[model samples]
Target: MTPEPQAASTRADPAILSIADAIAHPVKAANFPQTILRFRNDRHAATIGLDALDDKRWCHHFGRFNPMPGNLPQPLALAYHGHQFRNYNPQIGDGRGFLFAQFRDDKGRLLDLGTKGSGQTPFSRDGDGRLTLKGAVREILATEMLETLGVHTSKTFSVIETGESLWRGDEPSPTRSAVLVRLSHSHIRFGTFQRIAFEDDAAKMHRVVRYALETLYDQQNGENDAAALLNLAVERMADLAASYMVAGFVHGVLNTDNMNITGESFDYGPWRFAPTWDPGFTAAYFDHGGLYAFARQPEAIHWNLGQLAVALRLISDAPPLIAALERFGPLYQQALVRRFCWRLGVVPQGMETDRALVGAAEALMMQGGLGIDAFFFAWMGDATPECPADQQGTEGEALWSAFGAVKAGYAPARVRTHAYWQGDAPQSMLIGEVEDIWAAIAERDDWGPLSAKVDAVRTMGEALRG
Candidate 1:
């Protein structure tokens, strides 16, 4: 969804157009071959209101549709690289992705909005640069749902589907192709620094660091010179990891290039919420080794930040950067504890009992293969009481015994629905019920049910306020 900006309009102005024009190099950064014509707009998207057929697209990605436009990097688009999957591949930049231009709001702050899957730049190398249409659709749902779930993620500006098929042998068959327009604060990945660091180019690495600090961490500019920006970046990375872990999220690919200094989450791929609290959940299809597992996401983020520190250390004094990085563990732990407490409807304090409560919740999830979304969304109204006989047992007992217990807070009429019996209860649960509600609204995009669900969740959490 296009976020509610501070009175920002979807349309472009002369200045914006000029920025687009200035950065219209099609094959500059890592020039690759082949640019196909697959121009379509995200039809089912809500950000650009479908009411105005003229406004039914993200013009930022494509000035107009169906044209293979050259993307010369914005005069300011700088180059860098990083490690992918822990293996240092120095030779990488925006090989496939490119920055569109910096979107300036009325306040005059620059938002480095950009696009991915806009086919083949000089960096395309051996792979196809174009994104499949299904991939585009998947991103639309994934990004939007994530936004609703309050995860830091890149917003899907547009998803234009193309009917053509693209091959990915990993799956059952070839997938249809399409392009996606992604809106992000910035697309500079951890790989950018890794590339320069790997190349032993201390100057370029430092330049990119200085550029990012000035660009993203402008708040630090007023403080003591370069040291402030470096410290700010380190702090932000820790903050990002902390937020992510408490949200039950695993990015599944915490590669160095995927890390952002600005600290907002971007680069969505095979990401997922933990279904079980094992911390071993791996959402990426390629992560057979579980390198970016749910339990390891926090560690992986810090490690990536460490790599960034190493790269920056090449240009600056290592001690301050090291000190900044050293604070990551405590920063992440504190943030995670506080956020998780909030998620569980509790006010956080450094209480041992409260920590045990959190552990108990995780232990329960580990015992039940509950879909994380379904679990929380359905748990919105009420939870069934545990059986008296099994009061002292584990979470599995609670899961099993609660099947016949009464649930409070909802209408007495909803008691039957909350009873988790195999023979009774709604044949279809909340997702299905929500789907039905959505169908009615899709007649005219009525948002009542979704809004109601949100309200109900708040009410339930408040009532059970710990």
Candidate 2:
């Protein structure tokens, strides 16, 4: 039986007060004229105290589309420009989506309520501003999996299937349409700064930097200068990149526009989790050059950070900015070591020990061609680190010894009690599994498989957190 909805405990917050000047351009949502509620993420809604809303009330605010009290008066299609495939595109913006609202989470941190496929704005360059139902489903899975793995990512707030059909080149034509809302820490992208830099608007750039520092970073030490902000951003982005690497996630497109200033991963398009430890794995088919491959993700993010530094030059000199950019490498390396240790279910030792452990673990994965998720899940707590029969040779023994040395530092009683540790197979979200889940939905509209997958992923999350 479905559980009863809880009572509302929170209201909206006026967090994005700079929408009129620093960040966004006011716009109206497209008139899809039909609202069919399909999915609502009550778990995420409760983070901002909106989970108690009835279906009709939820649809009115997020679907039938009236702005909530203390939210933006109307949706604001944010302005920005980005480099697509390394080519600068000045005409890029929130073409189909808008910043619908802003609020504070339970932690009192500012959050954004953004949309995808809500409709067109001045940025919509002659295309139908709608999203296919399949797209919405894909995003939901992506965010859920990422969150489970402890990646800072956006939450899919609501998905309302608009009573319309969309024809697209990728999927089956005349596909069902839907509108999605995502809750994120911030919607201000690196591209937002790039746009002002491109226009040579120094005064506006300074204002944006100050606004971002105050609102997003919560830095009120009179250090809201461009150089200080860039320093903070570099550290955050490095940690974000390391999270992706350890999660075996390839974010397909790491474009400037897709990268938000808060370093949280959003806009899940063509994302994939590696089936095995293969650096060459590419998530997007069009990435024939392997620019954003599983291994090259750190490089892609570093390049994007360089572009951000270029934009910051509008407000600050080059020396401090360059110094800030120089910190990404060490920050990413340290973050990787820490994150890898956590995944191994061990308390991290010092940097040198952790780095050595990460290197040895990667070597083992590559040499044995082990499935990424399977290997991690199997060796989680070192309670019984067994080598596969096929991998019981000299090399495998050496790998096992190294792993054992690393695992000796942690106690296993915490995670051993979890039922997931007894499973024959680890919960994984490889391409085949995702496709199978989608096939179930597309063929018969059976949500059982998707629901089960979510539950399994959540179980894995609980085990890891313990």
Candidate 3:
């Protein structure tokens, strides 16, 4: 389980999964990232795409490839296992999935180019290998939207419709099947460790963890003992949860296996943007108890991190890992406040003001039953805010009140109509257009326009400080 560089028989490295041999098969690298369409309504998790549980992947050059290319990910793919739901499902590993290969994009970012709706493997359990079209469609929309929102997400590389009918609840029965391609840093999961550890491969487990840290985390020299590696892993997950909170993003299904040790948002199952300000909002339909609720996500993430610590503890002592775990709450708080402060056009110095402003924003959003996205959208244009400013406070109330009054005084009625939510106050005309532009950004991945908007938003925010 050691992460020795290019070990004779270690787990799969992203480089091993590279797309060097995949330029010839039935492949399409789209201008925009895509969704798998066929697995949309599988009810397993958010960002559900077509499950490649059964189809065999081939080289990009193959005319009618059945399994995998000789150089493709075969042996390294054997390193994964996970617990699905709350049950200890040690039988999970790429059941409906497999990495086609990993590659460096034109800009030098590493990406895993793989297929969903590909056929079954040893971990197939009992399900079919095919994925439905609607699953593909939903995933396409989810990926595009999330990335546009500036999220660290798995980008959809392409989508392939096999022109075959499959059945599912989210759409008409006898629907078509498809394969989805995703470009990500890594597909390795937390369960990848748990599964091997549970199997009594302490050496293999240690090997894999060491490999992951070197490959993904720092790619630096020297080895990370189990203790150092575990601390690194905890800090990453903590930072990730912190970032997710700031982005108003919620990962609906956060099983131990779903959490990626690489610090990227791994699985998109049952995921959703906060619809309203309710932290209790769950992205998955099956999460009736809100186990993976938007409000609960950070906590859920910490819980998953705890599980990771235990698994890592099998090789080392728990003291350092426990200390790393203790930092999550404060780390989360700082990240949350820092991010919220930036969004509000304020610095982090205003504690009471920042707290009140965020509290007020959430409270007003609750009263309006506005989704997080909706509230932020409305806040961009709100002139006569239903959200009140505390007359007595120096920072919180004054900042909001002053900004609201100045904004309403400057915006045009037509712009207000276009940008403001119903019954909300007018916002600064300069930024009103910004919201409209970001909507376009969120809906489309054609970076031609996205590039301009990204620059424009940052410029506007910077101008506010000056």
List per-prediction Cα lDDT, in the order shown: 0.53, 0.85, 0.54
What TM-score do all the candidates reach, one by one? 0.70, 0.95, 0.68
Order of quality (lDDT): 2, 3, 1
Q: Report the lDDT of model 2 for residue 309.
A: 92
TM-score for candidate 1: 0.70
- lDDT digits (tens) for residues 346-464 of candidate 1: 34556454455455555555664544444333333334443335334655666533432222212221222322222222111122444445354435545465445444443333333
Off by over 4 Å in 1: 1-53, 56-78, 106-109, 199-206, 220-227, 351-354, 368-371, 374-395, 398-466
Query: Which candidate number has the best lDDT?
Result: 2
Model 3, span 152-184: residue lDDT tens: 667655555655566676545766666666667
lDDT of 3: 0.54
Instruction: Output the lDDT of residue 118, model 2.
Output: 89
Tens digit of per-residue lDDT, candidate 2, span 28-67: 8777768888788888888887888799888888886787
Candidate 3, residue 221: Cα displacement in angstroms equals 5.5
**Worst-scoring 10-residue span by lDDT in model 2:** 1-10
Order candidates by TM-score, high to low: 2, 1, 3
